[model samples]
Every structure is written in structure tokens, then in C-alpha cells.
Target: MTLLVIGGSGFLGREVARQAGRSVTTHFRAGGPGRRLDVRDRAAVLRLVEELRPDVVVNTAYVQADWVTTAEGAMHVAAAAAATGARLVHVSTDLVFSGRDVTYDETSVPDPVTPYGAAKAAAETAIKGLVADAVVARTSLILGDGDSGHEKFVHALAAGTASGGLYTDTVRCPVHVTDLAAALLELAGSTYAGIAHVAGADALSRHELGMLIARRDGLDEAALPTARQGSGPLDVRLDGTRTQARLRTRLRGAREFLAR
Candidate 1:
């Protein structure tokens, strides 16, 4: 099957493309292994989708600070997927929640408290409206790979090269990029629809997660300073019990993966 992965240069998008078997990947500014197509341009997205007519389109592109790229850009991709009748697997975030609830499940409605969250939430809504059968997979902090931003931050913090403390109150279900990518690809071929939580099995604070990563990498765990969150959501935990039951990929916890 021909798969199209948007944001192929990104951490998760790169993994998605790598495991996609037969796939066409796209990048924005970064030099990608495949084509260069900005998701912000509706015509370009439509043109690529029309030309490829891929069986599946996994949109992993999003700019946290840009509304056009995060929200409107998603609309363009969704429209193209709709036009081509391709199965879509959209990557959403746990930030979509406001931490008003203790934990969020597939049935929970988005109540975002931040602009980034709002953008991601908006993108989720648009994709659902365009592709009725699409999988709106909401995930948490993606790690596991040492190359991921979070992992790199942990390494920098340990080396006393980075500023800022890991928030002790900021809770998240950090997932392995490999597991998340594998799960997303499996959902691409499955008939399951609607929002699905694809995250780690363990719920942890930012500081605690950093400690795990530090220990795994043989870094000075004590060097990683800790602090409380300043604003926004604090304890937004995504419960993936339902989605995990349906997937073949084992969504290992941070404690498990980092321990290795």
C-alpha cells in the first residue's frame, strides 16, 4: 500500500515514514529524504495527494505557535484526503486537555487551555469532519529515541548546558516513538475510527521522566534540576486502555523503555 507521511523530517513523522514500507514522505524547511511540500499550502497538498492517490495519509505536521500551520494546514491535508478517499491517521496531543479532569479517555471532549492545545484541537475537529473514518490519535510527550527533543533536553540538562528546570507538577504519559509510530501504522490499516489514546503505559511528571532518561543514559540524575509548572495544564493524563486492547503494538511505559 502506498502511504503518505506529512512532516517526514519530524521525530515521529520520520519514524512513521521509516516503518511505512511503501511510503512518500514530505518536509517543510528541513531537507527530507522524500519530497518538500508545505502542508500550509492547500493546492500543493491537494496536488501531491491527487498525484500519489495514496491508500493512507498520516498527517504528523504541526507548528505549535502557528495557527495557519497547525489548524488551517491540517484542513488542507484533510480536504485532500477527503478528495482522494484515503484513510487518515492524525497525530494529536495530550495538551488538548486543560487538566480539569484527572484522566482523559476516548469519550472525553477537548477543553484546551492553551493556544497550542487549541490549534491541535481545531485540527482534530477538521480532520474528523473531512474524514469520517479517520483515526484521531491523541498522544503524550513522544520520547524513547535519544534524538527526540525531550531526550536531548535531558542530556543537555545533565551536562549543565541547558537552562530551566523539569517541571515536577507537569504530568504526562510519555510514549516510545517506535511504539507510537507502530501503533499509528497499524491503525492506518485497521477499521477502528474516532479518537484513540496512543501513549505510554505509565503516568509521570516531567522531573520524574527526566530522572529516568538520565539514569538510562548514565548521566548525573542530580544535575537535572526540578521546578513547578508556571501556567497551563498540569496533570493531563491520557488513558489508552481501550485503544491498547485493540492494537498489536505494545505501548511500553517510560519506566520500562528508559530502564533499558
Candidate 2:
């Protein structure tokens, strides 16, 4: 399949590419080439898509720094996807929801809390308006190598424990980058159009997850503080029943992901 992976160099994007490459070889078909194009630039995005003429365009580009960046970024990407008539699989976040105590499904209305959540929710709106054959995959706290976004959580535990303690109240359901990437590829190929959830199997608090990581890595989990708290939403677990039904590869939990 001819595919265009935006933000192809990022943690999840790279894994999607890797899986695509391997899938192609295993299936005895050639995977399409990759291009590192920023989704925020309208002209550049349109030009790249027009030139590549890919059958599927997967957007993994987004910024957490500000709402403007994400809103603009996703706008151009959706536009490019519409212009090219390509199936667009846009990666969204679970934060788009209000982070209410209850677990969210695809049907749940998004009531974003933080600026990041609001930005992603806005982007979803733009994508839906622009493309008819678009699928928005809403994932949560992606965990892979510490080099990825997981570094923030990893470091937080290390630093918090070194100083005094860590927050046990905040909770999240973090999925493996590879698993999320696989689901993205499936979404790109399928006719499933709309927002879908993709997250880890179990819900875990920050401290519990940290302890698991510490124990697995032979770190001092006991030294970590039993009480740590942060601002914003907690317990933003997603119900990925739809994703689980569609994806071929088995979705893994944080423990299985860390073990890998």
C-alpha cells in the first residue's frame, strides 16, 4: 500500500513505519516511502501529498506546547488529506475527554480539561469536517522506550523519589507505542471513520506504574514517596473495545510493554 506518514521520525510514527516496513517484507509487498513533513505548513503539506499521491496518509504530528500549534497543525493535515482524497488516520489523545473519573468510550462527548486536550478536540473537529474517509484514533499516555514520551513519567518517579516522594493519586492507562502504531495502520486501511480509543489493558496510578518500572529495572521502588500529586485530570482511562476488535496484533498492558 502507498502510505504517507507525517511526523515519520517521531517515536510512534517511527514504530508505525518500522512495522509497515516489516509487514511489507513479510507479505511480499513493498511498503511506500516515508517523508518528514510538518503538518502545520499548509502549502508544504499540500505539495507533499500532491507529489506523493499516497493512498493513505497517517498524521502523527502534534504539539503539546500550545493549542494554536495543534489546531493549525491538524487543520493543514486534514486539508491535505481531503485534497488528495486519501484515507487519513489522525492520531488523537484521550486527553480530549474531560478526564472524568469514569472510563471513556468512542461515544462519550469530549469535555477537555487542559489546553492540550482542548487543542486535540479542536483538531478532531477540523479533521471530521475535511475528510469523509478519515479515522481519528484517540490513544492515551503512550509508553515505549524511556527516550519516548515515557521519559517524562520515568524521570518524574526518579526525581521525585530522590528528593522525597511521588504522587500516587494521579492515574492513567498508558499504551505501548508499537501497539498504538499497529492500530493506526489498521485504521488507515479500514473503512472505520470516526474517533476510536486505543489504550493499555489496565488502569494504574502514577506511583503504582512507577513502582512496577522501578522493580523491573532493579531500581529502589521503596524509596519512592507514597504520596505525590499533580495538577489537572487523573484517571483518564480509555475503553478500547472497538480497537481490540479491529486490530490483528494483540494489544498489551503496561507490564507486557515494559517487559518487551
Candidate 3:
């Protein structure tokens, strides 16, 4: 199948493109191994989608702190893909939900407390409205290959370059990037639309995850500072039961992936 991957240079996006192999055509904004196409430019996105007419468009493009790039850009990509009759698979995050809820499922309504979360939730809403058959994969902290932002933070802390304490109460389901990419590719081929919680099987706290990483990497776990999460909603653990039931691939937990 002909596939198009937006933001193919990102941590998760890069993995998706790599796993997709030769039939995939990738797009990047500033710098990457693919053609430069800004998702923020609606006309550009439309023109590219129309020209390529890919069977599926997987949009993983996102700027860390830019709301417009995260939300509006996603809408543009989804709309263009929909117009071209391309199956869209948009990668999302668990931050969309407020920490008030103990755990979130695929059916959970988004009540984002943070700006990033709100933007992602908005993007999800826009994609659903624009693409009827789009698959919105809401995943959690992606950890693998020590290249993701989360891993960089852990590495910085371990190397004494960073000095922030990790939250003991802040909970999340950290999935391996490889597993998440594989799942997204599988979902891309299916007709499953709407939200799917594609995350790790085990829920862990930030401090706990730090310790696990430190232990796995032969770093001093005790050197890592620890603190309780603030009053804001800290628990964003996603329920991956629905994803597991839908896909043949098993979403392994952090413990399993990091237990080298």
C-alpha cells in the first residue's frame, strides 16, 4: 500500500516511517529525510495530498510547545487526507485527559487541564469531524532507543546535567516507541475509526519509571531526586484493554521492555 507519513523525522514518526519500509513516502517541515511540507500551510497540505493520493496518511507532526502546530496543523492534514480519500492515522497523547480521573479508557471524554493536552484534545475533535474513518491513537509517554524527550530527560538527570526531581504520584503508561509504531501501522490498515488507547500494559509513576531506567542503564537510582506530584491532575494512566483486544500485537509494559 502507498503510505504517507507526516513529521516522519520525529521520535515516534521516525519509527513509523522506518517500520513502514519502501512503499512509504515521508514529509517533514524543516529538516528530515523526506520532502519538506509544512502541515500548517493548508494549501500546501492539500496540494501535496492531492498530488500523492496516498492510500493512507499517518500524521505524527507536532511541535513541543506550539499549540497551532499541534492542533490546527493536525486539522489541516486530516482535512487534506480526507479529501483525497486517504485513511488517516493521527498519533495523540494521554495528556488529553485531566488527572482527576483515576484511569482513562477509549470512551473517556477529554477534559484537558494543560495547554498541550487541550491542543491535542482539540486536534482529536477536529480529526474526527473531518475524517469519518480516521484512527486517533491516543498513546502515553513513548520510551525506546533513548532518543525520545522522556528518555533524554532521564539521561540528563542521570548524567547530572538536569536537577529536577521526579514525581512519585504522577502516573502514566509508558509504551515502547517500537510497539506503538507497530500498532499504529496495523491500525492504519484497518477501518477502526475514533479514539484508541494505545499504551503500555503497566501503569507507573514518574519516579518509579526513572528508577527503572536508571537501573536498566546502570545508573545510580538513588541519585535521582523524588517528589510528590503537585495539586494538578497527575495520573494519566490509559486503559489499553481496548487496544489489546483489537490488535494481535501485545502491548508490553515498561518493566518488560526495560528489563534488560
Candidate 4:
């Protein structure tokens, strides 16, 4: 199957490309094994999808603060996929939830607090409306290979190179990038459409997850500073029980994946 990975230069997108049989990737500026294309451009997106005619298109491109890139960009990709009749597996985020104390399932409504969350929530809505057969795989904090922002922050904090402590109150299901990517690819190959929670099996606070990373990397976990998040939702966790039963790939938790 020919797979076209939008944002192929990204952390998760790169993995999707690497694990696929035949894949053509697209990048904004990460400089990887794909052509440079911005998802924000509707015409360019349509042209590329039309030219490739990929069987599946996984869009992983997003800018937290940029609505054009996150929400509108998803719309552009969804529209392109609809136009070309390509199966789309758009990567979304659990941040779409407002961090209510309750666990959210695939059917939960989005009530984002932060701008980034709002943007991602918007993307999810756009995709659902545009593509009837698209899979909106909502994942959480993606960590892997010591290159993710979360892992890098842990390293910087341990080395005294970063400011601000990890948030103790804010919580999420941190999935390994490889696992999330594999789950996404699996969804791409399947006929399953609509919302699927593809996050880690465990829900942990920022500080707790940092401690795990620090411990795994032989750093002093206790030395990692911690702080409470000032505003917005806290302890928002995705309940992937239903989604897990449908998947073959196991979504390992932070404690399991980060254990030494």
C-alpha cells in the first residue's frame, strides 16, 4: 500500500514512514526523506494528494499556537483526501479535552481550555466533517528515542540547563512515539473510521513522567523540580479501553516504556 505521511519530518510522522512498506513523506522544514510542503496551503495539499494518489494519508503536522496550521491545515488535508478518495488517518491530541477530572472516551465532547487544545479540537471537528471514512486517532504526549520535547526537557532539567519545573497537577497519558505511530499505521490499513483514543495505557502527571524518564536515563529522579500548573484543565486522561480491544499493537504506558 502506498502511504503518504504529511509532516513526515515530525517525530511521529517519521516513524510512520519508517514502519510502512511503501511511503512518500512530506515535510515543512525538518529536512527528512520527503518533499517540503506546508499543510496550510490548500491548493498545494490538493495537488500533492492528487499526484500521489496514496492509499492512505496520515497528517501529523501542527503548530500549537497557530490555528492555521493545526485546525485549518487539518481541514485542507481532509478536503484533499476527500477530493482524491484517499483514506485519511489524521493524528489528533487528547488535549482536545478540557482536562476534566473524569476520564474521556472516544465519544466524549471536546472542551479545550488552552489555545493549542482548541486548535487540535478544531482539527478533529474539521476532519470528521470532511472525511466520512477518516480515522481521527487522538493520542497524548508522544515520547520516544530521547528526542521528544518532553524527554529533552527532562534531560535539560537534570543537567540544570532548563528553567521551570514539571507540572505535578497536570496529567496525561504519554505514549511512546513508536507505539502511537504503529497504532496510527494500523488504523490506516484498517477500515475503522471516526474517533479512536490511541494514547498510553497509564495516566501520569508531568513530574511523574519526568521522573520515569530521568530514572530510565540514569538521572536523579528526586532532583527533578516540580510545580503546579497555574490554570486550565488538570488530570485529563483518555480512556482507551474500547479502542485497545480493537487494536493488535499494545499501547505501553510511561512506566513500562521508560523503565530501565
Ranking by TM-score: 1, 3, 4, 2
lDDT of 2: 0.75
Report the C-alpha lDDT of model 3 over 114-203, residue by residue, as the tens digit: 888999999999998999889999998899966777777888887889978889988999999999999999999987888888999999
Q: Ten consecutive residues with minimal summed lDDT in candidate 4?
A: 21-30
TM-score of predicted structure 3: 0.97
lDDT (CA) per prediction: 0.90, 0.75, 0.89, 0.88
Query: What TM-score number comes out for model 1?
Result: 0.97
TM-score of each: 0.97, 0.87, 0.97, 0.96
**Predicted candidate 2 versus true structure: per-residue lDDT over 1-260, tens digit per residue:** 87777766667777787888733211101233443455556898788778877788887777688665587788887898899888888989888876675688888888888888899989998988899668988888777766664445556656663453446777778788888888888777888888878888978886777777776666666656677566677768899887788778567888776762
Order the candidate numbers by lDDT, best to worst. 1, 3, 4, 2
Higher lDDT: candidate 1 or 3? 1
Task: Give candidate 3 misplaced runs (Cα > 4 Å).
Answer: none
| C-alpha lDDT of residue 257 in model 3 | 91
User: Which candidate ranks first by lDDT, i.e. highest?
Assistant: 1
How many steric overlaps does candidate 3 have?
Answer: 0
Per-residue CA lDDT of model 4 for 1-260, tens digit only, reads 78888888888887888888455555553576568888888999999889989898899899888999999999999999999999999988888888764599999999998899999988888888889989999988999979999999999999999999999899899999889988998898898988999999999999999988988899987778999987887888999998999999999998999989
